[model samples]
Target: MYQRFRSFFLLAGLFLLSACTSAGITVANAPVPFFEGTIERDIVFDEESKQTLDIYIPDRATEERLPVVIFFYGGRWTNGEKGDFAFVGTTLAEQGFVVVIPDYRKYPDVRFPAFVEDGANAVGWVHKNIGDYRGKSETLFLSGHSSGAHIASLLIVDERYLEDGTISAIKGFAGLAGPYSFTPEAEDVKIIFGPPSQYPQMQATTFVDGSEPPILLLYGRDDEIVAPYNLERLRRKIEEKGGQVQAKYYSDVGHIEIIGAMSWIWRYKAPVVDDLALFFRENSDN
Candidate 1:
């Protein structure tokens, strides 16, 4: 038994090195059972080619409408797809939540507001059509990892990204390893967000005004990619503005492990999935 567990961890570690890629994530989740849910793939959320999403619905018997969570995958704003995150949808759906994973246009091909706008459009689609999937729109939540978290956070805090009604409909937001307050320093990142003049607009912290929905910020103390200060900055800003916010930090988890732990194969590393599900349930009316 110990040998089997060791082999699993070794394989998981190898995949974690390339966790940003679809193949890596797919292989890592290959061993996990999917009998807990059903998936609806390639649902169109907008007119663009990349503006599609996947929905995961629990198979458990329940008359109550399930709360919905729209999750975005991170790839430094350059690469990621809904299909790459089937593990996320499956695990979250297994928790009895309807999960929506959307694909947005990436940098070089597109930039800043374009990707963020795609996220908004995806939410709009979910707001209008998630009822068909047994999801309660009023219990809707937004969540993501890394750059995806940045996108979700911006949507919640910056009213300009989503419609007033849609923004108001959100019950809460959960961000993992988000770059909420980072200034673009790399050339590609700077170009992705546009000029220095628009940097503030790209930050979720810049728009905190005490009126946003409740937020849960989860981060890794050892994350080297995006500094922990990003989470601290956003948390402090929200507190200063009197907005509801909570934070959780995992001591041993890093940038990739923070999200990777969502997969059942690596779940023992952290209780990320349970934490997120609990946070959503705590905030949901249902």
Candidate 2:
């Protein structure tokens, strides 16, 4: 029995290290039954083809409205799909929050500000329509992993992507292994937010003025892709601006594992989901 479990975990680790995709993480999560929830897929949040989102609502006898979470998956701003993160939605929904996973235009298809604009558009749609799903828009929390986290954090701090009303509605944000501040050394990445001179504007750290909503930054100490300084720089800026910010670092966890820990199979590796739930609840009025 011990060897069987060890083999399973070893295989799972290999999968996670290779790619942080639904197929990779599902190896462990598929065997466990998901918590009761209603998954509404392919709901269009904008006129654009990729501007669709999925909502996961917990099954409950009471009609009490629940806090809403909009999670964006990371793909280095190049690749990702809303359907690829159903596990994320279902897991958070199980924790008593309505979870929304939105699809945005990716690089090669669109450039900076375009994808960010799509994010704002999605938020606007949620604020106007989430009540019908028993979600309290006023208690909305933004969250994402990797590049997705960059998008979410930028929306909250930049204030230019989202409308004032929509931005004000966000109660908190949680970022996992986000690149809050960094220079794009890769040619493709540079082109994604190009014109060299405007690179600073592309960073979330550029807009921290202390008036933004509370933020929770989660990262893995062993994350080589994003580097731990990204979290520290953002956290330091937010704190220097007198904004509410909290950070949690996991030892022995890497970039992909930080978010992968949210899944049931690898959840024992860290308390990523629990920390997210607590942060959201703490910042919410509902």
Candidate 3:
């Protein structure tokens, strides 16, 4: 009877946890006015399955051709949902830009190309559809936290993934504490970054070149998850290739802190935010 009760409680706990994961965040807590309005819907990028995106538009915009940013949330390529970032939508949307955040299939359900394909298609979707939301930059920017950053880096380094999905070119890339150039260390982490033998191609730095988009890289000095060397390597590579890339390393911020700093609570991250905005503004205006 004790075992039976234990299993029943365990199952109940799991169900409750999943419910919590899917539920909307305290989105209303974010300061108002930053988020003027919102658009919550799904677009089936793949017809066979319901692969889709949940996009949001910034509140105050002057014109129809507003700049657009596509954000990918990190979950180690598993166990993350769209509802997890309702706050991201609210915050960036308020910034006079349109943001599209998408949910891609996670591990065990589908692997690399599947999730990568979804990301590229999500960008294509925005490019093809952002005008409907008044997001009008011919230039598109990509940003992500942790694993999502990994995928972003990989997409730039290995352009095939985007080409396959029809996203053509990405104007800029931003990674916050992303595990770019991650190696076969930390046992499990190695599998996600690919065995060391794949080095240059898998490293986000390898893809930094004149043809590649400008990159604004941010990292925390105290990050325990992804090392600081990852950013250094990419910075050096991009510089070597004559690609425009700027990197900022924070002294006290940690991995998650860097992401938190971007929120409405920490406007200081605004510099980092502005770096991105300026990069887009400069590139798109031309």
Candidate 4:
């Protein structure tokens, strides 16, 4: 058991180290590339300080409007910042897609529905303003990893959060290792999405129907933090409603590594970047 544990961490460390240069980040505390492109920083999306976002314009500018992707980073609704996901913005933007990463208020400071509400506000803001950054309002997509995915999923499944027109503006939704069907058994999870009865409101599964935007569910087969069952459950629910949904599992990846593979060096682990680009393009109106 000891030897097996040692090997697991050793392999994980090697994989993580491989992406340092490509991501321009060696450690979590290392400076993220804030000046890589035309970055619009700290744009206010709501009244709270945490409800701010950063926009990354593609390197290749064109008169033709580009598709936009509004992404949220995952940290269990208690921790995370859009700055931590600069690599995600830069990589997707480099592919000629306008990317916006938003920061929402987390737990301890607030609780359930607040963060998701902030996500809804950010989407509304993007729908109203992405055109100024050369993005097509009609080609807007939503994506996130883990908790961020949960928030993004909720925005699509629950129409109440977004105005009718804004909901129509969403072309697709992509989630990475999102917990869409869990019942929140852990104390911390219960606190974040609990009172038991309220768990239904926090679940994306509760709102899945054929009316949702096209959905892509990506998961790491080896993920222990969020089991693959969550993906399967959500997929089943969507399919039952005759919704357009697809699920992909990466055998070589775990939770963090699935999203981590977006970096240049980690592409070999999983072609998440290419797959996502294809999914977004195929689902976009343009």
Candidate 5:
């Protein structure tokens, strides 16, 4: 009965994800005048065309430097686009953050640390260039949903991805439904992060040793796609190492719902945007 119930939620989550992708793209592209955020789109971070990012800035501008956030969208490390997360950038930007959503090469095209390397380079670019967008380089934060969160967390916890100085530039991190401690048994995941021997290097939890930036981990109690155990394991490790970490589990929320709650149409489902904003504010040095 327990296994059957979990299977039910897993199938339901899959259906919702399929429906959400199409609907989400439409909703994200729709004009949201109330938010009134300005966007600087398609800025190249790497030589490749897919290695581009979009910046969202709050409408009421001043010379004051706003805190910066680099958010990555999730697609199981296989599919997703920066445009699909336009709402995320705008919503956070409206809250006075300079938000960037980047595009990275997905699996098959590249695998195992290639995309992560792209993520690292993207942050490196932001560290050196965010000032041009009136953002405080010192107050930069990181965030992502699902596999995107995995990538974001790896960049924070794994120092080898970025230069020593670049790692310290990150003020904090927030992960919404991230998979941080999973040892992939699934075929596709294995292909993206495989060869068993390399699994440890792929896990953010493996690198937690009390030296990383503060983290806010948000998970859904009903998420069947990625188990809550992933969040628990990482949080425990970070805490044991004396690193600062905060975690919250929302009742009845599922994998996709947490991120969907960030959208204007679904904001009532959860306070994902508000929670992240507050966490960033509380943890930021700026």
Candidate 6:
């Protein structure tokens, strides 16, 4: 029941243009679709470890084992809430996928690996218990923007998140205008992604081994927040390693426009939404 929007294109269009207004934003707005009788519940991902998850399933979706898509919101690994991503549930779920959005530990509270660990563990819970929501646990796809995307990518490539425990593994991935090979220059940037955080090694580019599942990547040509070179590096890493990765660049769109693509079923300006659905559909374990 988050605030809903009527006009899709204009609102998203204007938001994407405002990427320069702050220290790069992670998650944009959270606008949900009109859904009734949908169920919401929480599950413990790691009880002793203080991990939990929020799952959303369609009212009409019960008989079938629907696909699951887990989302991690972006806030420079600092600030974001599960509620901030309410839009993703109705947006992607309308495509017949069960969507899980979890709030992982953020900066100051913890750091890089913590969020990634929490993300991976959340997926673990989704994998094991999603059937209650009639989710096809075997076909969970991972996605996020900016920092959230970074967490999703690292867990897939690094493999350490599962080293400690069991989490339903990811079958596919979609990154929206993410900074996979982010520049390690600026001081503030360096502190956030550099040095002790294993900045160099944590980059998604360095770990895009073809060993991971297939992927779909989207970015905007005018994204002032994350440099285009970062996207280039990520695409190169994935494609060169024999992994399946697709890119959609909106020459005039900004960083936030990519978020609107989540609502593409309604707006339909970008091909990202369909491309993501098709990616999971084609690669689904169902």
Reference-based TM-score, model 4: 0.89
Per-residue lDDT over 137-161 for candidate 6, one digit per residue giving the tens place of the 0 to 100 score: 6777898888888888887777667
Worst 10 residues of 3 by lDDT: 21-30
lDDT value, candidate 5, whole model: 0.87
How many pairs of residues collide in each model?
A: 0, 0, 4, 0, 0, 3
TM per candidate comes to 0.93, 0.93, 0.79, 0.89, 0.91, 0.83
Tens-digit lDDT track of model 3 for 1-286: 9999967854554344334533213322235434568776676656665777777865564466667778888887776776566666666666666777888888767755567777876776777767777777365778888888877777776767665433444577888888787564654445544556655555666666656677878888888978888888877887888878888888777765566555544335335566556666676653
- The models' CA-based lDDT, in order, is 0.87, 0.87, 0.68, 0.85, 0.87, 0.71
Model 3 CA lDDT for position 92: 69
Instruction: Give model 4's clash tally.
Output: 0
| Pairs of colliding residues, candidate 5 | none
Answer with 1 or 5, whichever has the higher TM-score: 1
Off by over 4 Å in 4: 1-36, 48-50
Please report how far candidate 1 places residue 42 from its true position, in Å.
Answer: 0.1
Of candidates 6 and 1, the better by TM-score: 1
**Which 10 consecutive positions of candidate 4 have the poorest summed lDDT?**
22-31
Give the alpha carbon lDDT tens digit for every residue of 1-286 in model 1: 9999989876776575455455567665675464466788898888755478999888866566899999999999998787878888888888889999999999889888889999999999999899888899877999999999999999998888888778777999999999999999999999998799999999988999988888999998889999989999999999999999999999888998888788755677788998999999998973
Tell me the spans in candidate 3 whose CA falls farther than 4 Å from its real position.
1-34, 60-63, 164-169, 190-201, 268-271
Which regions in candidate 1 have their CA more than 4 angstroms from the true location? Answer: 1-23, 31-33, 48-50
Of candidates 6 and 4, the better by TM-score? 4
Tell me the deviation in Å of residue 103 in model 2.
Answer: 0.3
lDDT of 5 by residue, 62-125 (tens): 6888899999999999999998888888889888899999999899898989989999989999
